[model samples]
Target: MKKRTMRWASAGLVLSLFLASLSFVPSGSGNASAATSKSMAALYAQIQNERAAKVVALVNKERAAAGLKPLTVHTNLSKMAKDKAIDMFKNKYFSHTSPLYGSPFDMMDAYNITYRYAGENIAKGQKSAEEVVEDWMNSPGHKANMMNANYNLIGVGYYNGYWVQEFIGK
Candidate 1:
């Protein structure tokens, strides 16, 4: 019985060592793979590309509706359309009486207003993303109002028959 116990213990030790050795050794495959994680710049670039693609799709849909060829979408949307858009966003969505400084920006297809910029803010004069979000939050009376209302505003955009939105810090 003692001899049998010793054998079993030895076998267990051998199995554990084999597993530990396997983890320490590099893969047998000759080729190395891309890094599993990306830098902040890479991540931002990827997101920018994704966002641009969505914008393009929405713009193309609008052009098709107008019987025009597909063209690239730019930030330089006509002032009339842009102003009307900002108004529709505030009045129809939030029912705000006063002009909103910044809420999320959005684009809509021809059928109706179906797309938004999700978490992106539309602060008129704020330059950076941080300022756009923070300035709006800390604006005079906004903090108190938002805290009382218990809801942070965000945009909801869509692309290619699917809803797309990004999460931004509150």
Candidate 2:
């Protein structure tokens, strides 16, 4: 097991270096920026409006389940969330070993997922964001990792069809 892990570690290091090099290469910067903006615009709008409430609720719910006190939008947690994300990015496993480095945008995705679900629950008259998070933690697809030292729970989003994808890409 030790030998296997070492081999995987070396491979991951090589891959990360390769990807980092690729990301630094100059290749029509404007196109990439435009494409990213176009792809992310809808998601941005969704999160700001509809999904924001749900995500806040989900995080609050998870906090409650972990025996931590619940937080709110106006809570100190809103600012602390970004701090936690930076800490996650600095973890040795991510900074040294994993080829897939965590990014703020990725953290935002998790936030949006939680917020969207929480908002939906509110609309359905499910008052407890903590309950929503607890149910999600018990869900089949939730994955736990040591990387989540600060931000414990992150949501997984599913796509039902290609319509949204096509719309976003176009």
Candidate 3:
């Protein structure tokens, strides 16, 4: 009889533990999912921002080697570049001229970025900041934009697999 009672008690304890585990399990409801999504988006944006900053530093190092002044990051231009990067990623297009924003100049104008000279470089599918910068350095046109002594301001944006670098002189 004592063994029988012990077996029943153990079964009850196991059942209680199972029930308690269910309460700890995620419900996968709309609210919890939405919160998770929001946090993930914010974290992704932060990572992209860090990548963009690295691009700026690498570009500056190249400019320094070329005896050119380091370009300062402009907040307005950064915002514009980020918008362009996101737009290209979402719209599945890649170019200096965007379907939504026409040209880089048009994007700057839309963003109210004043500049005497402006240039933009866009790339897709490059894995890291160094790889993208190296690719741009190897290209004649992109190298021109990066090496141009006239440009004193820069904005870099990276999102998913897209990158945009905006150069401005004022």
Candidate 4:
């Protein structure tokens, strides 16, 4: 009970911090409510532009020395991002009869997570799985997760367009 309570408290604190760090546009300010169509890469570029200026500078500095192209990366968004994503898969997504037992998730080292799924079912009235992932990746929880993992890269790999879902950490 004590352990569980502590975990809950920590989660709450981290979640609070994550929310506090979020930058929001005021209501009806700068097309905040309007739906502007943008491709995934465009949206990602925008997020990188706004959220990762420091990363951009560092990457440029290093790449200039190495004569390599600069890179933009995504880090975890919140403290609970990975945990919540894993739990969502274990409790809500994966099939109960899966051979992997309780969760088809593997923490592939301190920073990476991989999941093998026969299939996944999103909760009733919830967004599709892709949307869920996108939201989670962009949430405050992702940063928390990244910090905990001591990772600097945010990447997702789908093998053969099925079976394997690998979350990358660098």
* Full ranking by TM-score: 3, 2, 1, 4
User: Over the stretch 1-170, how does candidate 1's per-residue lDDT look in tens digits?
Assistant: 99999999999999999987755636674322233234555775565445435444543454356554544333323222344334645454332222442333332232133332212223343333333335545664532322322222223232222222222222
Candidate 1 C-alpha error for residue 37, in Å: 8.5
Candidate 1 stretches greater than 4 Å from native: 1-38, 73-170
1-170: candidate 4 lDDT, tens digit per residue: 99999999999999998876654556765643243434555685554333334333433454446554443343432222233334445565433233333332323323343323211211222223343334433555432332323333333221111112222333
- RMSD of candidate 2 to the true fold? 17.2
The local distance difference test score of model 3 is 0.92
Model 3 Cα RMSD, 1 decimal: 8.9
Scored by lDDT, the top model is 3
Q: Per-residue lDDT for 129 in model 1?
A: 32
> What pairs collide in candidate 1?
116-157
* Structural similarity to truth (TM-score) of each candidate: 0.23, 0.25, 0.80, 0.21
Highest TM-score against the true fold, candidate? 3
Q: Model 2: runs farther than 4 Å from truth?
A: 1-52, 58-71, 90-132, 135-170
Clashing pairs in 2: 54-114, 54-115, 54-118, 54-119, 55-114, 55-115, 55-116, 61-130
Tens-digit lDDT string for candidate 3 (1-170):
99999999999999999987755636556466567779999999899999999999999999999899999999989999899999999998887788999989988998999999989999999999999999999999999999998899999988889999999999
Worst 10 residues of 3 by lDDT: 22-31
